[model samples]
Target: MCHAHFEDKYLCRNNRISNIAVPTLKMRSPLTPPSTTSLQQLNLGHGPSPSSLTATMQEAALPSTSETNVHLNLGEKTTVKKAKSRVFLTNTEKYLQDKLVAASIKLSKMKNRFKKLSVNVKAAKQIASNPAVCDILENCTSTRKLLISMQCQEDHKKEKERRFTLQEKIASLSIFKQSPKGYRFLRFFLFCLLSKH
Candidate 1:
């Protein structure tokens, strides 16, 4: 019975070793014939170093802090520029306000002058329309009208003398023609001495 038990244990151990050895043999079979090119390609002497590849991956994964800082600085500069422009605009607005105030003052003065001129014109029109004022002006200017009438009479007398001279010349020419008799005959006899014809 001891021999029978020892034989069973030997068979179990053999089965376990075969099971373990089969996978180990399969796993070792591919590695046992080492391809020198494949080994050299994986080793440090043939390909890019692991340190440079890790650094490239790390740089790709991280965000750029300097680009964000530049954007922040640009934003601050724009804000400062805007503040300066606002100050300039405020100063210009104050200047315009002062100019507007001065212009308004001048406009008010012009309005007052127009009011005075309008009042004076209204008073003059009113006085001219009043019959009492008209009579007063006419009475005060009687001597001036008398002088104007005297000058008009002198002009009329000069016109009458020129007309009389023209009539006399016309009568002398008609007497020389002697081809008439009635009112013209009486006018010729009164103005001309008859010659025998």
Candidate 2:
């Protein structure tokens, strides 16, 4: 849709060099109905009761699979209660699982190798489901521990360097007042100075 603005040219990001990034946009997607009012317009402090809000949400939500139940006996009507499934993975583990899968994909496709894009459980499952992707991602889990160990090592090295640089920069860094906007040029990147020389 932004073709008019871009003039059919791809988006470009500049660092030391220019990199063209082609963005993927899903078209003809269903749009949600307009909201009755904005959050700022409502009295959030005492707008609605928690139970009432929950009930409203449930009413608005689509019917779930659990709501549909099969009954063998037509003569007698009965209700069956289903127990909630237990969650085995914690929030952090679930997060890392997704990241792990994405990373593996991007790494696979590097020079003479598949550039692994992601390393996560969901991505891994998707890749495993595809015979073609599986052919490419044969050693996903076998290298998981290795990838994690390498990540930890890199983090440790960066942290040690940062601390050492910060100690050295403290004596040299001079404090100066900033602009009228109250933002100034950062003397150090996250308190660790990088030498230009």
**Which number leads on TM-score?**
1
Q: Name the lDDT value of residue 87 in candidate 1.
A: 51
- The C-alpha TM-scores of every prediction are 0.24, 0.14
* lDDT by residue for model 2 (1-197), tens: 44333323454444222245343454456688766565435645558867888998997785655554323442234322222344479899999999999888766656333233344455857756999865654556633433333343343356435333342333323322223122233323222233333
Which residue runs of candidate 2 sit more than 4 Å off their true CA positions? Answer: 1-88, 111-197
32: Cα error in model 2, Å: 76
Q: Write the per-residue lDDT of candidate 1 for residues 27-102, one digit (tens) a residue.
A: 3235467788878677767677788899999999986999889999999999999988875448888999899999
The stretch of ten residues in a row with the least summed lDDT in candidate 1 is: 17-26
Leading candidate by lDDT = 1
- lDDT, each prediction: 0.59, 0.47
Residue runs of model 1 more than 4 Å from their true location after superposition = 1-91, 141-197
